[model samples]
Target: MAKSKFLAAASHDLRQPMQSLFFVFTALERHVGTDAGQALLERLGQGLGALKDLLDSLLDVSKLDAGAIVPELADVPIGPLIDETAACFAPAAAAKGLRLLRDAACDVAVRSDRTLLGRIIRNLMENAIRYTEAGEVRIRCRPAADGVRVEIADTGIGIPPEHLDRIWEEFHQIGNQERDRSQGLGLGLAIVQRLSRLLGHPVEVHSVPGTGSVFSILLPAASRPLGAETRRTGPAADRAGDASGLGRVALAIDDDAIVLMGLRSMLEDRGYEVLAASSGDEAIAALERSGLTPDIVVTDYRLRNGQVGTDCLLRIQEFLGRKVPGVVLTGETGQDIVSEIVALGFGAAHKPITGAEMRAAIERQMARHAGASASPVPEESRVAEPA
Candidate 1:
């Protein structure tokens, strides 16, 4: 517990500067136009991306160890969730010249936390794709007596029988004795084990030395029908290109000046009219001075003077005399914080957000509230999962 808490606090602090670095990178990406400069920038982006991935994994491990994540069980439709997750990895799989396939998932509903389950599937898919050199990665879903069984199979290097048990241990990887970061930090399966245990899902693995491997998880089937509000919510990478916030007004709130400046620059670069503020009062004043209502509200979860992003969003809505699409950004992994952000109909994303992530979050909220005349808060909102 002590170690977990310490890591969590340290990771939270690290995310601040990490976010600033991402902002700086975003601002810099627009200026380098030459092929050589772009190549260097791409290399730099890869390094930064690797760093971000490591930090995110470490944060997940610490949060899970500290029991900071709570599963919000729901009747999540397996088909859409699987399809959406698979789509996100399509680009990566294609880059490796591997075929990614999903068997026609039946209209099966699972009784589990949707977000956690998606994470489990994503981690397994990523592992399969990373370890595989050629052939294909396939996903299948079918009805089982125990529950709905979802399996991901890969034509990659298989695990040895003796080492199967140790794969769930942290930093355990086969064939990669050099500890290659490209092979991943070996925390994906560890996270999968912890999440499966928390959700009471049974995970099974089968493999042969050089042929391939299969990973499966059995989720308890939901007896009730799917609710009207139940739907897939995640980063639409395919649609991100069209999610430009052009000609729209965006209000960005954060206490950190560097983050605020970087964010403003990034958004302005994306062709949005941005109003940046360091606090609730400043935000309100800025909005009032602009004499233009904002199309979206983006704010950090924690602010100076003991304020929270949720309260600030509400205050803005009250001041505007209507509910506006909002997104809450934070590095905190506590369930209570995430729950509050979602329950209030605000989109949520972890801190150190990239320009793509921020834009996706904004696009999602705006689409959700589009064409409504000051619609009340929706019943459920899914936070943006890690890319």
Candidate 2:
């Protein structure tokens, strides 16, 4: 309990700066024209991404420890999931001169939670590519006696026999004693282990110190074969080529001046007319002064003077005599807090959110609000606040 609280507090503080930097970098991406400058920026972006990954790993551990992740089992086709995950990491493998191979012919389906299973595959593949300095990383699916075995094989520096079991422990890196961020924070396998256990999947690892390593997961076969599966794309994919905020007015509030500035800049870049503020009163005042109804509201979850984003959003809606699409930006990962935010009929996004992610959240909320406007107010939004 003490450790979780400390981790949450530290993460909240660190994510503020990371969020500001993300917004700044997104706004800067369009200005770099020279090849050399672009390359430097890309390297910086990779480093930033690594930092974000490490923080996310910490949050995952905390969430798992808190029993916040509940699995929803279904018939998950293995082929398409592997294909999508492989596509995401193909660039990383190519950058390291490693071949990423997959058994695309396998059409087997497994009964498991798709998101959790995909996370397992992703962590294993990331771990494989990180340790392997040469050769190829291949993912193969084969039939097992009672289930299917998905294996990731890598030809690089293999793990020692004695350290095989210890590798699953948190912050236990094989060769990285210096705690290099580039190599990773050593939390990937820890997360994989926790998630695999949660999903009732068994994990296995074998390595020859000088040759290579292979990691496998055993998943139960689906009772029935999969029918035609439609890929589940999140809000980002739905608005892939249409990220423009043209003619849309947005009201943003944040206590941190830097974060507020970054938000304003990012929204402006997306062609939004922004009304920015640092507090609820300021936001209301700005709205009244502008005499323009904002199409969306974006605010930090915790604000100055004991103000919360949900209340601020509701207050704004009350003043305008209508519900406006709102997205609450927070650094808190407590499940109760998240559930409360969702109960308020507002979209929720964790801190250190990238520019693209923020855009997606805004669009998703706006789309939901548009759909709900034609009907009565959602019952969830009318629930009384918890004491």
TM-score of each: 0.86, 0.87
Instruction: Give one digit per residue, the lDDT tens place, for model 2 in 51-162.
Output: 8887888888888877878898988788888887788889999999999998755687888998899999999999999988889999999999988999999998999988
Candidate 2: stretches off by over 4 Å: 24-47, 229-241, 367-387
TM-score attained by model 1: 0.86
**Alpha carbon lDDT at 358, candidate 2:** 92
Model 1 C-alpha lDDT per residue in residues 1-387, reported as the tens digit of each score: 787788788888888899988888888888889999999988988888888887888899998998888888988888888898789999999999999999985576889998899999999999999989899999999889967999999999899999999999988999789988988998899999999998999999999989999999999988686565555553442243247778888899999898888888888887889999999889889989988789889899999988888888887776776789899989996878988899888989897777778778777888887788975433232122113
Scanning candidate 1 in windows of ten residues, the lowest lDDT window is: 378-387
Model 1, position 96, has a per-residue lDDT of 98
**Alpha-carbon error at 32 in model 1, in Å?**
2.0
Give each model's whole-structure lDDT: 0.86, 0.85
